[model samples]
Target: MIKFANYKKLYLIPKAQGLGLSKKLMETALSFAFEHYEQCYLETMHELKAACILYEKFGFTLLNEPLPATKAGKFNEEIVPLEDVNGETITSDEINQTESTIEDLATLKTIFKEDGTVTAGNASALSDGGSALILMSESYAKEHGYTILATVGQHAEIGCDPLYMGYAPFYAVESLLNKTGKTIQDIDLVEMTEAFSAQSIPVKKNLNIPDEKFNIYGGAIALGHPLGSTGSRLVTTLAHALKQEDKQTGIATACIGGGLGIALMIEKGVGL
Candidate 1:
């Protein structure tokens, strides 16, 4: 679900977990997402510390807030510690001045608990998959009838103990509001990947976005994870839904492998 308007960076790396799959995906995706903006943004998990180190190379940093990704240890035991996921220690120093937050680690742990705060019910379903999308400017959208969802607002990445890898959405959403002139109250809907139920519930409660504003259609838990594609998938899904329903301002984000996350906000077209 990774959608980059006016950029062509949708590359699929089969069985990519072994050979820096996350890095390659972002390298291409960023090239695409940023082609239209002055800057680029993304997120990840502490569980995938290796990927975290690499993204810093491209100016990807932690923001004052975190992106969203719920936990899934309750429904399944698929999740592991951030260190276990990377097989190496990733100190914050290595991440440098990258954007991130404090709640990230607590949220990371919640993603892998059998009865943790974050559970599979709300988090995204883990599986092997990839996705891509193309967003266009208003002028271009009008020319092509590209359905306008929410506008890409702000994004950030954060880290923590692998256990709570699900709380990133809090920061990611907060930053989006700060960047644009909006708040959770202004957001009409959201398409958060179902990494865990805890991830979404807490974020909704904290941000005051309301349950109705989140994943109306089936999320990753019901559909499928498709890893690399989840971020872009959320973006496109939100936009498509907003346009179809004639709403304004939708947000999307996904929990990444390396203790991080990615996010975007789209402003719906006026009175459709």
Candidate 2:
């Protein structure tokens, strides 16, 4: 199937910006995309006004609404119930209250070796919870005449420095790409755990993943993380995001404690 463009994050050094350099970069990237595909697609946030203008100048039309992924009537609008680590029903007020403001985040204590960036407010909160999913064989699923929403593509686990455990997802993504023979350019959506702003931010910078595709919706930084269920939660979120975004193929990755990283590549599921 023909897919979307790989262009997203474009950057120029601070001193070199606003010299038409951004447009030059987009031209080069779009030139590459044109060579490989008939059409190119990109997404940007409202804050990137300049970039959005540049995209529009290049003939990228802005859509008024999100495209639907499934042939089913429309995107699922189910309201998911949320609970905190304490098993108490979490209200929207509680979620809003937990939002870390710049001042609140600044006041948080740095826990990881005094790194000022790894603050309690920026890192995911500790919580008690778990998640479970039933994985049936493809053959079994077909025999039961069940509709499939997605299928597993690839998975990888890797180890990294214990002291810098947050970099685990980087290595995991590397290993996963190696296994699938696909570049980061092939990924449409990504669900990287907000283990800490310190960890997630740098990795994204190093990889050049666009802010739009990395986590369009709020993540653990906004929602509290439940230890064992965090990965599963990411998977669930990615699945729905793919459907909502009307795209296929995504990566869900997490940095684990004790120097480990895990990643899974999943596509939107389809009926047999």
Candidate 3:
């Protein structure tokens, strides 16, 4: 289930005031809230009605209403191209991958729920592949002259109802943000496993991640989901993606079977 949080006030340090930091801070905080929380409450005095206008401009509404409704097709259309792009980069001979054309997906038959959008065209393919990571402590890396692309930041796991398994990433990411004292605005890129279009769409919407910053190289739906290697694949791709984009921070998350979700934060190494 989705959750909510409230921010009753926002204060700026004396030295940081009057330099237009409040707007930036408020935007960052609100964007994070909208992404990670189901609802957000902001309390301000009547004298601050002008401030309320700012909040409304950022998508705040009376009684914490939900965001506008979105159709599954909108997400499907957007996702298919990303998957095709990612598919082009795969060179492993062990795995057989195929591009998902929008025209094909539009005509494919649903295989999951009756009349549902879930279909063979948009689901992750069962495949064979292997992935591994060599992890070392920061001190050890420095001592050994290792080239660090990124450092692990925070990790979180959460449990949810099995019926909504795909949404597990939302909760897991929320927990990671809270633990690290970070916000979605702080994340420069995200690599979420696209087990299915139906699952990935909701998670992306709830997280409020931008198209340019999420799964830029496509995802499991197109690249094929080698279940045992998916996690390592995500981590490996995320590290390369961050460096390629010249970004400093990223998160990789996925929903697991049996009502569980997982997320890990990564930050680029200093001076690299």
Best by TM-score: 3
The candidate with the higher TM-score, 2 or 3, is 3
Candidate 1 lDDT over 1-272, as tens digits, reads: 33323434432333223332334543543333323101111122332232332322211111211122222112121122234244664221111123333334334443333443332222344444444665557678778877544456556555543334455667666776787778777878887755544344455556776546667544664455664667776776677667656777787866554335556766666332
For candidate 3, lDDT tens digit of each residue in 1-272? 00112332322332322222223332442234223111111111122122322322221111011111011121221221212223443223222233334455556675434654445554665544556787888889899999887798779999975555567898999999999898898889999877665456556766898867788666676556764677888888788777766899999998876557999999877431
Best by lDDT: 3
Ranking by TM-score: 3, 2, 1
Give each model's whole-structure lDDT.
0.48, 0.56, 0.59
TM-score of each: 0.50, 0.62, 0.63
Give RMSD to native, each candidate.
Answer: 15.6, 17.8, 19.6
* Counted clashes in each candidate structure: 65, 2, 0
Model 2 CA lDDT for position 55: 24
**Of 1 and 3, which scores higher on TM-score?**
3
Better of 1 and 2 by TM-score: 2
Worst 10 residues of 2 by lDDT: 36-45
Q: Give candidate 3's TM-score.
A: 0.63
Q: Number of clashing pairs, model 1?
A: 65
